[model samples]
Target: MNTLDLHAEEFRQQGFTVFRSVLPPDQVKLMRNLAEGRYRACVADPPDRDTLRGGVSLMRAFEFGTAFRDVLALEPVIQVVEALLGDDCHVISQNVLRTPTGRGIVNWHIDDALFFPFFADLNIDPKHVPVYSLNVMIALSDVPTDAFGPTQVAPGSHLSGRRPERSPDLPAGWEPVSLRAQTGDCYLVNSQTWHRGAQNETGRTRYVLTTAYGRRFISQRFYPFINYTMPPHVLSGAGSRIERLLGAHDKGPYG
Candidate 1:
């Protein structure tokens, strides 16, 4: 099988898969620059120190600039997403998540809790694959060690159809795996998978750009109606596929 086929199969069985160095180094550098610049600008203002200390999450990033939108249209990345979600898949949310030094741990949880019921109702088996939605996590900075708080995931836990218990004793067969990636790597994760952001003890900030996508029928996680509007230049320059992915073609209630 080809690399795409292998990734699809791995995603079905493991609930997540990583594509190493999927984004160009230059593109990754650009994203890192944008995120760092925005964070610095935000920190300069009078916002409390608490805001500056933790993860800096910027939502509706695609609307912030063309570079953010450009990442959404990256051909190779989109191809893997399309392989799993089909050609009609559309982005539900886009954001840049930056974990600053000494940021506390992000507790383990599923991306969308609503999906648990759907999985249970359907009696989806561990081996039975479903593609409701996914989050494309693009690493904009090197995450070389635990101190950087790389993403920790419990493989195959998405099949549990619920969040893993907080107790020390986990469900049988569940084991947490910390994902390590160089700048520009991307990980495609099933929205229902049990995962968390580890504590950042590193002195430097870790940057990640996340874009969530789902089949066109799935309701968006954020306000699609107001967030979809982009600058006239951006809108005019976007292809039809990019427009649909950006929620322009969404007719769902939230859209």
Candidate 2:
């Protein structure tokens, strides 16, 4: 198997894996500028700031700029995501996180409600674990140390099938791993994995472009749940892969 396949297997077994130098330094700068600009705009516009959770971020940020939209299609990141969740995987959510000095997603928690919860006494095969969704984090800034507040994941936590909050106990032989990366690195994570951003004290902002992918059976979370339309300009010259990533889907099972 090649490096990406190994990385995919690592993602399956360890709950996450990082791909180094996925984007060029210049491209990282461009995306970082776009993200910071979006954050600043959100700050001025009270409505946009509402997406800011424990960390500074904007949900569905790809809708605003082509640079952000381009991020969703970066091949290195998609390779691992598609390998784990299948090629039919499409974007479930695309958001950006920017944490400056003294601020980060300090709370350790799962991304959402447990997707495949099981009992402590249940015997399960690690290979049988299903991946329903994915989290691909594209780091536009360097996260070389704990002080930079890189993401931390419990190795194999997804298979534990227990929320860190409720269980708080590691499955035997599991340990926490801090996902530190250089600028332009991309990391693939199972959404079920227990994770959180470590505190940032580097006096510089940590910029991460986050994209979530789900299997064909899962629905795209474009929000509003009613009549949200993808802005035409964003898809002005996109190809088939980007369109699919942007929620363009052919008929699938149970449709």
Model 1 misplacement above 4 A? 44-55, 116-127, 166-173, 221-228, 250-255
TM-score of each: 0.84, 0.90
The top-ranked prediction according to lDDT is 2
Q: Give the C-alpha miss distance for residue 77 in model 1, angstroms.
A: 2.3
Model 1 residue 113 CA deviation (Å) reads 2.5
Which pairs clash in the backbone of model 1?
Answer: none
Q: Model 2: clashing residue pairs?
A: none
Pick out the ten consecutive residues of candidate 1 with the lowest summed lDDT.
46-55
Per-residue lDDT tens digits for candidate 1, residues 1-255, read 898878888888888999998778998888788777767766776552222334467666676568888778686778878888878788888878888887734677777654655565566655456688999998898999888989888887787657766543356867888888899889988988888888789888888888999987876654345464455766668788888887677455655
Q: Pick by TM-score: which candidate is best?
A: 2
Shift of residue 175 alpha carbon in model 2, Å = 3.6
Task: Report how far off residue 88 is in candidate 1 (Å).
Answer: 1.3
- Please give the TM-score that candidate 1 achieves against the real structure: 0.84
